[model samples]
Target: MLDPISILNLIDDVMYFPILIIVMAIAGLYFTFKTRGVQIRLFGESLRILLEPPDKEGAVSSLQAMLVSTASRVGTGNIIGVSTAICLGGPGACFWMWLMCIIGASSAFIESTLAQIYKQKDHKGHAYGGPAYYIEHGLSKPKLAVLFCIFLILTYAVGFNMLCSFNLQSTFIDYSFYNPTTTPVIIGAILAILTGYCLLGGGKRIIKITSTVVPFMGISYVIIALIVIIFNIYYVPSMFELILKDAFDFTSIFGGLAGSCMVYGIKRGLFSNEAGVGSAPNASASANVSHPAKQGLVQTLSVYIDTLLLCTATALMCLSTGIPITPAVSGAPYVQNAIGSVFGPIGPIFITVAMVLFAFTTLIGNLYYVDNALIFLNGKTKPSEKFMRIFHVCCAFIVFIGATISMDAAWAMADITMGGMTLINLPVCMLLGKIAIDCLKDYEKQRKMGQEPVFKAESIGFEKGELDFWD
Candidate 1:
């Protein structure tokens, strides 16, 4: 029998692509106009919040929340997905990708603001909230909230995060010394060890890990890309022309180009930033702050950091370096080749190890997201938490499948699933956005009256509530 996944891929290409992309783009566009460029105006404010997140009351510091969210946001989409777009869509894909970031940033910010507004303390007194909570709390639809949580548990935790583990382990095998079949076994063992360590400390530990590792890998990739870019500095001018040519050249001369490339660029950009997908909001809800808009703005600014800054950096490094980007063998190796062309084999190897690191952090971060959704259902079972560790183990072993599967198809299907999730999330954000604005105004009003900012934790913390570890 044909692979069950193969059947799913066929269905995705035929059905998922058309319906999802159009809807996400339209929603993004609508939010963009409605917000009147919060992404632009609040960009500086977002950075300020990130650099100095208040730490007295919220579940986590604002910076930690942003980092955990970014750890997830910045993964495969930045490194591999950027190359995939350039390969399939050509040089011009970068422009469309930029467009997507502008809008997606707005979407993420709005989603985050809403999440902050609807945040609540769980039975254990941990602050818990997200798109699901907002859907139920803000809209007064608890049934829909449960549905949202279930979808998230399936899409983000079990499916997307597990898929990331597959990316990480397989990349190590595919690009390194280990054989593909054997690598996952080794990787799986390591992941089991690491997962146990990280989960023991919880989201705070995961953020601490990713916050350090992610920026290092991203900077290293840029450094390597820069080495290649310097060698081909003369080719830089033509890159803009090439990108425009592919993006706008509508002729059959372009062979289903233009629209095709634009779609891919936008699709990949959306996938990378994940603003409308509602994943980032879960992270946002964790921030300890009185002003909901503070985290909203910070989360929104992350799309710029992830896509516009980081992803664009990858694209420029590849395309401007004048390496002949081929469609057939697309991925980090292509990015590696673009750099290695100048730096030699070391470039690819550097990318190889770095991607493994980046993917690994994402694997950890996405699992945290998955854990959050699962908590919503099973209500934070020590048993459920233990079970979730196995959830990631299965994902780690699934890494081997990466070697056999076509990366393009794997990513394309991810895009489709991601798009569907975005559609569910976007309308909720738009409708609930007014709530965030009101919350922002309320916080501002409090600030004007010289009230100290406080959140669920400080207001009803175990200390004030007469609760303890046993209680």
Candidate 2:
């Protein structure tokens, strides 16, 4: 029988590797033009919303919604992913990443906006909406909706969700300098306790945790990278030129460039911010906002935080340090080593703490995603309680995998699974673009008129009919 790896490789080599990038890129480009560059118009507004008070009708506050998404976005992927991309694809990958982010931002807004515009509520008065519901209810295609949800439930629960734990457990075991089997078991124990805390508390608690940890960890890493950049400020100009030269040189069939780093960087960038992937919509839909467009704006802004702010910092830190990482280093730990090459002993300690914060919060945040997917697929989910519990246990097991599994395998699995999530989400966004734009115009109208930005769901004038879930 073929192994699981073979199956994954076959699907990836033949199918996912191509359409995933093309469709996502096209979607991003299309949205950029369609929104009249809304990503640019509302860029500052996205940040401004964080400071303002939330509208109180939604399940969570605006800041909390961003945090929940950030919790998942700012993981080992930000640092290690960036570093790996730079090492293989070279510094030029960073620029390509920024390009992708700029375009992808609008797509992020469109998908997330639709999620809010077509939300479906539970009997408990809490809101539940994402690509799954949007595809089903907005597009009026239950089969396609179920397919999306099934892929998401599997990707979030089995592929991505557990991987976060594995990264955490394994990171700590190495930091603790422990033995082989003991490390994973001990790490699993710690992860189990923490996972239980957030999983039991629900999305509210998960968002609450993210609001505290995500910024702290992300900003902290940026500060650390800043120090490295400062010491190498003199080379900054030459570095930029080098980056530009390598990126455009073109790799392989494209050109003379090595292409390894270029491919890795773009792939890792996508893996990091997850814009246009539809997963963040699950988190964004819970926010009580003045408008659906407002939530979508913030969702797009998060790609900047994940890719431009956090991931770019990792790239600068590694590139400036002159580390011997021209060949990819795996995840956050490689970043730790690169920093340590410059900062000495404190480097590992700093990264260890950052990774713990990054991976732990990711676990909590992604588990909540798993929970949302479960609740979405199985309405009245009490019957799936046992399965949910089993899912939780498997989550702990996956954490062990991240902790001990090969980085190549881990990275490949994440990118492939994330591609899976994006495939389900991007199609719905394109099909429902008109609804998203209508929501954006309504939001702008309310804000422009000096109103408090509260409009009834029906008044937004999207294509969808029912939006009582958010009421």
> Candidate 1 on 253-343: residue-level lDDT in tens?
2465323677678777877888788898898887777567788888877788888788988899888777777886466656777777787
The parts of candidate 1 lying over 4 Å away from their true place are: 1-6, 14-17, 55-59, 123-126, 169-211, 252-259, 379-386, 389-393, 399-404, 440-471
Give per-residue CA lDDT, model 2, range 254-318, as digits (tens): 55222444555567778788888888988888887767787888887788888888888887777
Measured over all alpha carbons after superposition, the RMSD of each candidate to the real structure, in angstroms, is 5.4, 3.5
**Weakest ten-residue segment in model 2 by summed lDDT:** 251-260
TM-score for model 1?
0.83
Question: What's the C-alpha lDDT at position 156 in model 1?
Answer: 61
Q: Kindly state the number of residue pairs that clash in model 1.
A: 4
Off by over 4 Å in 2: 1-10, 13-17, 57-59, 169-214, 251-259, 380-384, 456-465, 469-471
Scored by lDDT, model 2 comes in at 0.73
Clashes of each: 4, 10
